[model samples]
Target: MRAKNSFLLLAVILLSGCFVSKDTPKKEAKEDPYEINNQQDNRSLADVLRKYSSLTIQGDGNNARIYIRGQSTISLETQPLFIVNNTNMGRNYAAVNSSINANEIVSVRILRSLSETAIYGEEGNHGVIIIKTKNANK
Candidate 1:
């Protein structure tokens, strides 16, 4: 009877460790509004951008039109400005992303708000997407 009681006590002790106490902190997932990390190589830039709720990608490949969720501009040009390697690639997001080889891309940074887009002036009134390519120096 003592052996059975000992075994039961051991089991209870082991099981008690598995339960999480209320005092134990829970982890929360933080949202990144600037850049979306793409680990999967199977998907294209447009496909990856589509995963973000803030970005709306229309068309495909070089013809794709990228738009921000809440645009405050009066002009019909809802397309966000694309900047590649510190140079402005105009308002064609598709051309900018498609022109560069996927392997050459290092990271894509997005500036959505007017304050963030202020550097480009009226050109960036809509929004801005900066695509950085891997340099031979690095």
Candidate 2:
């Protein structure tokens, strides 16, 4: 009777161990490029571009030239195509630099790969700097 009771208790303990809950490891969420951060306030568009490892900025301020590291300039235009709020601002860096403030930008995306820039056609060949302003719809 003592041995049977001990065996029953052991079986219950083993069964309870098997029924224990296990925590499932969670998958990390991917970072979104378009997600605007509150920390970017009062910053210039050029300052934001500097954060990217694939980009190279030459000169300073209004004369600043942005270049994608691996891409070669196929035409006389050295600057990349600037698209602000879906409007093509051409290859003129000054127009984009002077018009848009850093604080006004909701998101800044650089399309360097041919596959990514192909949608913009020939103008995006050198690469493309797409800026989404807070008042994009306005």
Candidate 3:
């Protein structure tokens, strides 16, 4: 009876170790800042621009024209200048739309304020869409 009771106690101890408490805390999954959540792999730069509240996109796809909402343009050109990885892509939206891949984009920033876009000179008079890609050196 004594040996049987000792074996039962050892079995209970081993079983208890296998079970986890329901109140135990779980580690939460961390979100990546550069990640564009719920976006498709084939998403275009125009699709990504729609996510931002400060800008407005007219039309669709390659022919799409982007404008800074609530910001007055100094020039007749409504299209904002595109700066990709510190390179001036001019005001042509079709060229930029085709050249850049949405998956390679790290971040997209809009320089709407005059003070913010003054560094780019006359080209930035309307606004600036600064695109930082994963491979900036490329």
Candidate 4:
């Protein structure tokens, strides 16, 4: 009778384990890019990105390719458009961002939505990272 009771108990425990819930609510992922104000250290662009969110910065130094959340392009070029002040830096946008001193920057705004980036035409498809410097001509 003792052996039978132990067997039944073991069976019950095994059955209960099958019904246990493994689906726990996960934390809501932040889709928006964080804004950094009062620019302090002249840290590298990749460093600034790493400090804010869980971004994937592939490559070295200022030449790194930054991948923003939910931003993907059909073309081979996955890099986002880097706009300084009111002027677009064209193809070498990433280079421009790396060369600029972080201390000289006043504000960094990220335009993620399709509507927000639509104004710039196809170039804005990937996403628009607008960096305003302290001396930017408004």
Best by TM-score: 2
Worst ten-residue run, lDDT, model 3? Answer: 31-40
Candidate 2, residue 15: lDDT: 92
Q: Per-residue alpha-carbon lDDT of model 3 for 1-138, expressed as tens digits?
A: 999999999999999899989999998898654355544788888898888888899888898989888767555788889998899999999999899898778888888888999999988888899988888975
Rank order by TM-score, top first? 2, 3, 1, 4
Report the lDDT tens digits of candidate 2 across residue range 1-138: 999999999999889877635685677898786655758556666787788877898876788888877888656776788999999999888778899887777788888899999998998898898889888999
Instruction: List residue ranges in candidate 1 displaced over 4 A.
Output: 1-38, 136-138
Candidate 1 structure quality by residue, lDDT tens digits, 73-136: 6778888888877888899766766677655556677788888999899889888878776652
lDDT measured at residue 109 in model 1 versus the true structure, 0 to 100: 78
- TM-score of structure candidate 2: 0.73
Using Cα atoms with residue i matched to residue i, what is each candidate's TM-score against the true structure? 0.65, 0.73, 0.70, 0.63
Q: Quickly count the clashes in candidate 1.
A: 0
Relative to the unseen true structure, what is the C-alpha lDDT of residue 10 in candidate 4, on a scale of 0 to 100?
99
TM-score of model 1 vs. true structure: 0.65
User: What is the lDDT for 109 in model 3?
Assistant: 85
Tens-digit lDDT string for candidate 4 (38-105): 44675766665555443457775757777667876667987777888888975464677666777676
Error of 3 at 1 (Å): 75
Q: What is the C-alpha local distance difference test score of each model?
A: 0.76, 0.83, 0.86, 0.71
Spell out the clash pairs found in candidate 4: none
Candidate 4: misplaced stretches above 4 Å? 1-40, 91-93
